[model samples]
Target: MGVGGAGCSAAFAIASSQGFQVTGCDIEKTSPYLDKRLKKFVSIGHDPAHLKNSEVIAYSPAVTSFDSDNEELVMARKRGLEVLPWDLFVAKELLKNKFVIAVAGTHGKSTVTAMVGVLLEKAGIDPTCLVGAIVVDWGCNYRVGESKYFVIEADEYSEKFLNFTPNIAAITNIEFDHPEYFRDFDHLKETFKKFADKLQEDSVLIVGSDVNLKNNNGKTNKVSGPADLNLKMVGGFNQKNAAIAAAVAQELGIEKDSIKKTLESFKGVARRFEFIGEEKGVLVFDDYAHHPTAISETLRAVREKFPDKKILVVFQPHLFTRTKVLFDDFVRSFTEAPVDKIILVDIFAAREKDEAAVSSLDLTRAIVGGKAKYIPSLEGAATYLVKEVSVGDVVITMGAGDIYRLPTRLLEKLEGKG
Candidate 1:
């Protein structure tokens, strides 16, 4: 019922495109996918009345986790409706009888999923696709193609990806994340291994060179190095993502020319190193790099692109559990890159309460050098940046939270609008 989120919204859109009469509700009234894709009215908040006519209710993970006593969910249970999480609903209903190409990993799955979708479309495969982020070319998170092929960004959180048995799969890379759910790194790896083992006989499983899923059922292919082709997207990680997509396309018998053409022209998904705009010679970009590894890789890429430019990073740590669990890595990630300044805003705390021991100030204090500063609010960060930022500076808004809103404020202030 929470269709405003990226995952649930894409699922709802796919269901609607498949000619199902779907109704949705969310705490928020608006989203980009709601506007561009499912342009219909949805209930603003959860209510038992909202579930009146629905035979089956599909809910987002956030809906149940954040508010277990939500009225709609309670009512659905009382009525004995067949309620399912969005992932399970998509897997059991929509993806049935399809050639599923599921992409799973800690990072890069969204880009790889979008790339595979675009490559398949270029090769006239007409594959139905769903990714976690909005692909710039598609202008949405899903494509409703006519073929039996289904390409999806299979998420690992809560072991949700285990719902689907893919004919083809890809593991971009694996790292410990979602500390609140997983016990440790070994648990996370075991979950991935289980996912890999779900593949059908003679199916293909493409992995990065560093991934080691020992006993997967499918034929394994290891892809390494930056793709040799010219790419429009920056970063070594993206080149690796393209290489994985190429491997998948090759497995499906797509022509080399078509794969190359798609990867070269692919614009990229929203918020993964998305360029906002430039003002007064200060280039602004927004990225969804909240994890320590992603933060390091992204900043390294930016430094490589603009070697002489001073990078001002505005980082909002995503969840308190994550910040606490990976605090040391977070500290080291900043130092690994040549970033000039790091502004740390308060942790986003997506679905968790504040931990007394961990905060953004703690992270700032943990940084080795004096490059980091703790700003408690987005408004304060924007104000400080507008005053401190100058020519030849590359400003990056890095986070998975509402920190994306800061870039617009900074751009407006730069234009003297505020």
Candidate 2:
């Protein structure tokens, strides 16, 4: 897998559990996740030459530059070594043993996926779950289990969801995403409809109650479609996620009481509006809100949860292409929030250059209520926060990239003031 966020964690989890002889080479060698997983076998740097002896090459979605490695993977194919995408490989292997609850959506997918995994484990379900976060309960992103269920975070990138035929499927919302891969909004929704149809006949399909499903002939938020069912999970987004999971559990005859117990105990994911404990009356949070829609939804959730708190948002743009393509939406994402302050960081630029001339400053200017600026690095941003952030303030660090380090460092600095 490429040394990106979720992919890297998932690779480590899989390697730990299966005790498979694992070797990894990535452009980023010092990453803690990769360091821990491939301690003895890191090739030190990414070179396709190492792909020579590998039986198959499994890759993440952000592997655009691997055109250089095509020949190496192709040579393995010539030798009948299977080349597989990570999503498909997980789905296929997961189906072999375990009850899988595959959560799929453009955003909130990771948060909700992590939520179910944690809740189930805490309730003594003893089920194995794979999530987008490094779940503390399992000590990694992937958990080895003796149970019959395999809960997984199903990704929708490049139609990766098509690989697994799920007993349960969900659509958090149908928004236009991954402009790099998909053509238009309709095309993306149609792809989801196709995935919904692939669900088991008597199974369930959970959808965002707000979005309309035009071609979903299967179960939906309808009279006959399984809409009216009760889910114990809270928060507007989580309610939707829980509704989908509940529909699946009910279909499988899981006791409603058991499901309700699971939802109430759900603590939620690490970085999706996750509360990172309070320090000196300041509430710190981290959210994986990289996309425009995701940023909007998470801000709305925060506003709803903390109606009166002064919200200080530290946002870092994830991909340059996404920032350029969804520039207007990104501009409007914070409009609805009565934000007290905003600190914008330089674009994270994952696998894309700033050819489109989009930058965090562009977004800063477009937002009306909150003031924003382009703070370029994590250290500088954290230093700025130490001075500007006031008590009764909620410092929410938002992004999908290494922006997580900012809040962590800021917290450390704040604690030192004690």
Off by more than 4 A, model 2: 29-43, 48-53, 66-80, 97-99, 118-126, 200-202, 211-234, 277-281, 415-418
Q: Give the Cα-based TM-score of candidate 1 against the true structure.
A: 0.98
Question: Which segments of model 1 are wrong by more than 4 Å?
Answer: 35-37, 214-216
Q: What is candidate 1's lDDT per residue for 280-325, written digit by digit as tens?
A: 7789999999899999999999999999888999999999999999
Q: Judged by TM-score, which candidate is best? A: 1
lDDT of 2: 0.68
- Taking all chains together, each candidate's TM-score versus the true structure is 0.98, 0.84
* Candidate that scores best on lDDT: 1
The clash number for model 1 is 1
